[model samples]
Target: MDKKLKRKVLTASLVGSSIEWFDFFLYGTVAGLVLDELYFPSSDPIVALMLAYLSFSLTFFIRPLGGIIFSHIGDRIGRKKTLVITLSLMGGGTVLIGLLPTYAQIGVAAPILLIILRLIQGLGLGGEWGGSLLLAVEYAPKGKKGLFGSIPQMGVPIGLVLGTFTLTMMSLLPHEAFMTWGWRIPFILSALLVVFGLWIRAGINETRNLKKRKNPGRLPNYRLLIH
Candidate 1:
């Protein structure tokens, strides 16, 4: 790949990875503070907090499954397509959580839906990390593969910082307002980031490796285990 195109791919990979992690970590930041009260309320504040954190933790288990499933799809279909789907899933779940009605508004169904969205977000993230890293590394020019691979890793800290900074800013609102709606702003705003990431990723062609594969055959879980 040309230097210009490699740069574009690297940028796209980094941006998309950052956005995904930002959305993923946003929930963790909000869970103890806002989700407990709004989505997982209980008479005992501790109980509510635990429930919220439980939702946060449960997603971790689903992530590995997501990684396996999406990796297979990436191998068979294409990394670009897989990355787009994962981003959509993560962004879609985040936006929905922002728009979701609270337990006060929807009763038991609210927390259930919130958990479902969290799982979706987890799944997207599970797939997102590898694909983003691969997208950067695969497009990298000789002698710079390590450097290009490191670029996507930057997204982890970048996303964490961005998520924390956004919430800190939003929290400055009056407590009632912050609790009522301010918390959702970051989640909703993720849509714009997703759109921008998607636009950037859409411009890049499929990596040469996938294109060169004449027959990308299926590799089931059992086969993977055997290997």
Candidate 2:
């Protein structure tokens, strides 16, 4: 790869991951609090919280699945496509959640829809982190893979912290408005995030390693590797 292009790709890999994760973690911060009211209104607080937490946990647990799928695609096809797909999955899930009706509006179906969206989130996120790091790592200069990988990893904490702050601020609003409408702010804001993630990823070159390799023509060996 050309020197300038490689650096450009590296920047995208790093910044895009940061932005994508920022959007993702935002949902995590709001997961239990807002989802309970929006999705499970008919249930008691305990049940609603429990269900919301389940959905939250599901996102993380499903992350491995996304990793596997994205890894295969990344290793086989190219990093660029995999990242695009992952962003689409996550962005779509986030946007859909913002549009979802509350239980008051849709009864039991609200929580059901929320769960499905959560599944999409889990699947998308599972793919996102691994590929984002791989993209950066593969583009890094000689002997700099470790550093490049770390750079993208920073996005995780940055995103998590930003998400925490955003949620904390939202929590300050009155309970009624916060529950009824304020919760939508974060979800709605994902539009800008998705657009940003795309801009960073746009027109960038594929990872050098992926470009050099021929198709592997097989699913990734992603199963747990217990000895």
Candidate 3:
């Protein structure tokens, strides 16, 4: 691969992975800091928190479904379209949560809507992780494969730290205002990151390595390993 092309792929992988994980990591943060009142206000504070955490954790369950659907699409159709779909889903889900009606306004329907949105988010991130890993390492030069894979891997910790700080800052505000509006800023910020990610990812070239492989049939075998 040309050095210029390597640079482009690396940039795309890093940016896209970062944005994807940012949406997911921040959702976990939101669950703890905001979801209790926003979605499930009827429960006792502790119970609401446990429910929020449970809802937050459910994203992991749906992520695998996202991964399988996306990986197949990536293997059959291509990575670019799959990535675009994943990013859009993640961005939309995150932003939707910000706009969601609070339990006080919407009553029983609020948490239900929240759970549905979370599943969409899980699906998006499921695709994001594996696809970013493949996009980074697939075309990397020999012996540097681990390093290339590590670039996308870095996005997870970066996202976690960002989420922690964002929530902590919001937590510092007057409790009412923090609950009312401060949390939305993080979700809305995802839009800017999504645009930036798209700009980088739009330029990534499809891997010719996949093109050379006539045996897409072997892909299903990977599923057993995934489970």
Candidate 4:
């Protein structure tokens, strides 16, 4: 692979992974800070917070299932295509969450729908981390593989910083406004990040390693191992 192309692929992987994770972590932050007040409101504050945490934790459980499903898609279709699908799914979930009605408006349905969206977000992310790493490492030339592989790893901290920073800025709004509408801004704004990620990833060519494989029929076994 050409040096320039390797750099492009690495950048795309890093940026896309970072954005997906930012969307993912944003939910965790909001669950403790905002979800209790809105989606899972209860007379007892402790119960509301516990419910919010439970919803957040559910995403972690669903993530592996998402990995299995999307890994299958990656094996059958291609990594680039799978990454696009995951990225879009994650972004769509985040945006929808921002638009969701509070418990006060919809009663029990609010928490139920929030859990569904969290599952969608988890599913997207489960597929994203592996795909991003592959996108980076598979494009590396010779001895540079380890360095390229680590680039995607940087996404975790970068995503944490982005999520924390965005929420911090949004928190500057008055408490009522922050609780009422401000928190949704980050989730809705994820759509723009998704647009950028998809555009970058669209330019990435399929990895030559996959193209060189003579037996595409082995993909189902790969998916099973993921399970």
Candidate 5:
């Protein structure tokens, strides 16, 4: 690949992965700091907090399923398309979460919806990491494979830093305002990041392997793999 194309692939890989992870981690931060109050309310703050954590844990278990589903699509369609789907799914989930009604407003439905959103976020993330990693690695020149392989990994720390920074800045608000709306801003603002990531990803070419492996009948049965 030419230098220009390589740079575009690298940028798309890193930025797309980072944005997806940013959405994923940002939910955890919100779950820890705000979910208990907004989604799961109890007289015992401890109980509410624990419930929120439990919801977060549930997302973890659902991730594998997401990975399998998306990977199958990636195998059949292409990495580029699969990643676009996952990123869009993740972005939609995050924005919906930001707009979700609180427990006080919706009673039992609040926490239920929160859990569903978390699951969607988990699924998106499960598929995203692998695609991003491959996008970078597969696009690299023969000698630079190792270097490119490591680039997508950078998304982890970058995402954590961005999530932490966003929360910290929002923390500057008073407790009432922070809980009321400040926390939601970060989640909702993810729309812009998602849009940018998708734009970059759209410009990237599918990996050579995916382009060459378009025979669905020749692909392994994902259901068997899952079983």
Candidate 6:
């Protein structure tokens, strides 16, 4: 690949990976601190926090299923399209979470919706990491594939730092305002990052590996089990 195209591929991989992780981690950061109070309220604070963390934990269980499903699609279709689908699922769920009514407004439905969105986030992320890594590595120059592959992995820490910093700053608002709307800012603003990532990924060509394969076969179910 040409230098310019390679640069675009790596940038898309890193940016998309970072945005997905940022959205995923944002929920965890808020689960104990904010979601417990607003969406999983209970008479006992401990129960409420546990419920919130439960919602957070639900994602991990669902992620493997997501990985299998999307990985099959990635093998059958192409990485670019799968990346777009995963990002949309992840980012759309996040933006909607920001807009959801609290338990105070919707009662049990609030937590239920939160859990569903968390599942969607899990699925998106499960597919995202593999696709992003492939995008970077497949397009990398021959001798530098390892270096390019590592670029997408960097998104994890980058996303964690950004999520923590943004939430910390938002936490500075008065308790009332922060609970009321401040917490939503980062989630809502994530839409912009998603849009930007989509644009970048859209401009890149399909990976040479996928292009070379004229007839990509189905990903066997046993392979999923092995992985």
- State, as a TM-score between 0 and 1, how close model 3 is to the true structure: 0.90
Off by over 4 Å in 5: 217-227
Q: What's the lDDT of the predicted structure labeled candidate 5?
A: 0.85
lDDT of 3 by residue, 32-128 (tens): 7788877877547998899899988988899999998898878876777788888888988888888888888989898999899899989989998
- How does candidate 2 score on lDDT? 0.75
Whole-model lDDT, model 1: 0.88
In model 4, the Cα lDDT at residue 100 comes to 99
What overall lDDT goes with each candidate model? 0.88, 0.75, 0.82, 0.86, 0.85, 0.88
What would the TM-score be for candidate 6 when compared with the true structure? 0.94
Spell out the clash pairs found in candidate 4. Answer: none
Instruction: Give the winner by TM-score: 3 or 4.
Output: 4
Candidate 6: stretches off by over 4 Å: 220-227
lDDT string, candidate 4, 110-185, tens digits: 9899998888988999899878876677777777778888999998999899999999999999999999999999
Candidates 1 and 5 compared: the better one by lDDT is 1
lDDT pick, better of 2 and 5? 5
Q: Which residue pairs collide in model 6, if any?
A: none
- Comparing 3 with 5 on TM-score, the higher-scoring candidate is 5
List the pairs of residues colliding in candidate 1.
none
What is the per-residue lDDT of model 1 for residues 96-185, given as tens digits with 9 covering 90 to 100?
999999989989999989988989988999889878877787777677778988999999999999999999999999999999999999
Cα lDDT tens digits, model 6, 1-227, are 48899889989999999999999899889887889999987899999999999999987998888888887898788889999999999999999999999999999999899898999999999889877877787787767878988999989999999899999999999999998999999999999999999999999988777777777777722232112
Q: What RMSD does model 2 have?
A: 3.6
